[model samples]
Target: MLKIIIAEAELEPMPRSLRSLPVMKKKYGRKDVVLLDSNYHHTSMQTLPDAYRRGRPDIVHVCLLNALESPLNKDGGLEVYVHTRNDKVIYIDPSWKVPKSYNRFVGLMEQLFSTRRITAGDTELLRMVNKTLPDLITEVSSGMPVKVMHYEGAPYEPDPDEVLVIGGFPHGDFVSDLPFSRFSIHGEELVAWAVLNHVVYGAHGT
Candidate 1:
């Protein structure tokens, strides 16, 4: 299996501080929780710390869409996880179909944030756990070598069952320093979804 971890993803529920903003309230009336989106709340986010890198759930959205639809995933050779900036880990079922519409995807994520899990009848399609990125890595990787995708790192080579970590933010570096070795397939900086697609294709030797 090729296990991919979208680490330090900028995905989270709206903070209490932002909830009071008239723009936020106007956009999301009476909703106690909603996905923090920079595209929709850019002005409100400027006051927050590390504002440039936060409120980018769209990064995670595109990454998930690519990973879940890739050839590796269809062949049951891929496993995907999302580790949010807030230290929350999202577990994705291989069979779950991600919504193609960005708005719908955001809504699903908001629901997941509020309820902590999305269920299809009895089988859970998505679930969130309160765990740090390192802890989650330790659990999923077992004894497999863990590698992170980085442009400055060594050239990447695909290894079966290896845990691959990709940054899920738009432009900045990861907030948490990961100890794993870093590898890169591309020479220049690419978006999270582009890198994810590269990894997926490389895994299948395509």
Candidate 2:
């Protein structure tokens, strides 16, 4: 499996953030993958009844939409995560069915934000995850040695048991103290989606 961390993704519930879902879902939403939404800014989880009354961390909506449409999430299922800026982490059940139509999608998101969960009949989708990404790495590796995606260092050599970490922000360098290898797949910086597509394709070979 290819484990990817979309670190520092802005989850502001603005129009831009909401629109980002379709774009991200079109790209990184794939089978055999786990995309972690790390350090996203979102509405306070404790404020349940008024969740959407504020604004949700749209990255959760985007990532869940991506995973619901992923082809590789068929059998074993994909374990995806959302790490909020406030340090709260939740794992989304991959089998959660996302509404397909845009109107329904919006409504569904509202319900999820307000209730803090996803339910299709008896199934629950939003699960609070406890594992932390130390230095954004170290543990949760479980044989998948993590790699930092950069624009420098050696070329990216994809491995089945490796975790790929990429910045989801518009522009910024990673904070110091990344303990894994860093390599660039391009000479210059690419937009988040471009980089996302390139890296996943390189790793999954399709």
Candidate 3:
């Protein structure tokens, strides 16, 4: 029988669709599948030791949204098949070209200007930004402001909608109405644009 262990941080916060993995697995075959939510304990990795002793799973998959980029290490535990989604982490690699789904205006700004001096206003750019705003708001308010900084830069402001965006004045122009936003070349195109640009145009009721 194939046994799969799926580990993630918080099941409630994740979308119900994603949380239904165990139910989906039952449809395929008969196996011992465990979906573990880390929030039940103080430390997620701590649960692994006990879980391992109970039964060694055939395949272990960590499903946290940003597990790959997490500071925690998965090196010392039980030796078994381990797989993680690479999309969670964002790192710049010269060999890979930036995806084209990103806003052209925002992309140009990042390439031409430093992260500290970037902004966006195009229709598509706004749409992408709006999509990621709510998540950013929850993250920032949760005391993980550094995550917000990871996308943009230091110091951010959450708009009335609770969407966190870059907060600064552009080009040393104290009087200029233009707001300073930053964008990094990482993650999904839409999410990357929202974080780096410091603006969420479409996010409403968030």
Candidate 4:
């Protein structure tokens, strides 16, 4: 079985903090990413590698989409956990229907921000896990070695009793206490979704 963890994912609904950015004269920014609200504002970093910091939400979303759609997921060969920026762990339901539209997807994810716990089953994939990143990784390790997808390490190789931790953040490397065997599939940085595809496909073959 192959389980995938997206750690410290930047995925989120439009944050009110984004209201502080300078408004541009376009609906979508120069990067072709959506502007959050009526202000049409974009942060300075928005023009950088990650536009509006929007890639994370989309990255997390597409990762699940591909994972669930994979043959591995159907045969119980795959499981997914997404740990978000606000310190929430969403154990995604493999059976959940992913929203095809941006607005609907926003509605689904916005629930995670509330102080109240959401009650849902196959529909709401966001299962509120109160565990922090280190604890969550420890629990998932389950007396097995944890494999981290790091650009600095060697190419990835699947192992029995191993869980792979991939970076979910658009920028920055993972800095944590959990023990992991770092490995790399490629020298350059691949987008989160691309990395997910490679890992899932590679693991499925072994």
Candidate 1 regions with alpha-carbon error over 4 angstroms: none
CA lDDT, every prediction?
0.88, 0.52, 0.25, 0.67
Candidate 4 lDDT over residue span 52-90, tens digit each: 344356667777778888877877778788887656788
User: What's the true lDDT of residue 203 in model 3?
Assistant: 20
Best by TM-score: 1
Best by lDDT: 1
- How many clashes (backbone N, Cα, C below 3 Å) per candidate? 0, 1, 2, 1
Clashing pairs in 3: 182-196, 183-196
Weakest 10 consecutive residues of candidate 3 by summed lDDT = 78-87
Scanning candidate 1 in windows of ten residues, the lowest lDDT window is 197-206
Regarding TM-score, does 3 or 4 come out ahead?
4
What does candidate 2's lDDT look like per residue over 143-166, in tens digits? Answer: 677788888867887775667776
TM-score of each: 0.96, 0.59, 0.17, 0.76
**What residue runs in model 2 are displaced by over 4 Å at the alpha carbon?**
12-68, 75-79, 98-116, 128-132, 135-139
Model 1: lDDT to the true structure: 0.88
Model 2: lDDT equals 0.52
Q: List the residue pairs that clash in candidate 1.
A: none
- Using alpha carbons, what is the TM-score of model 3? 0.17
lDDT of 1 by residue, 60-139 (tens): 88888888988889999999999997899999999999999999998899899889999999889999999998899899
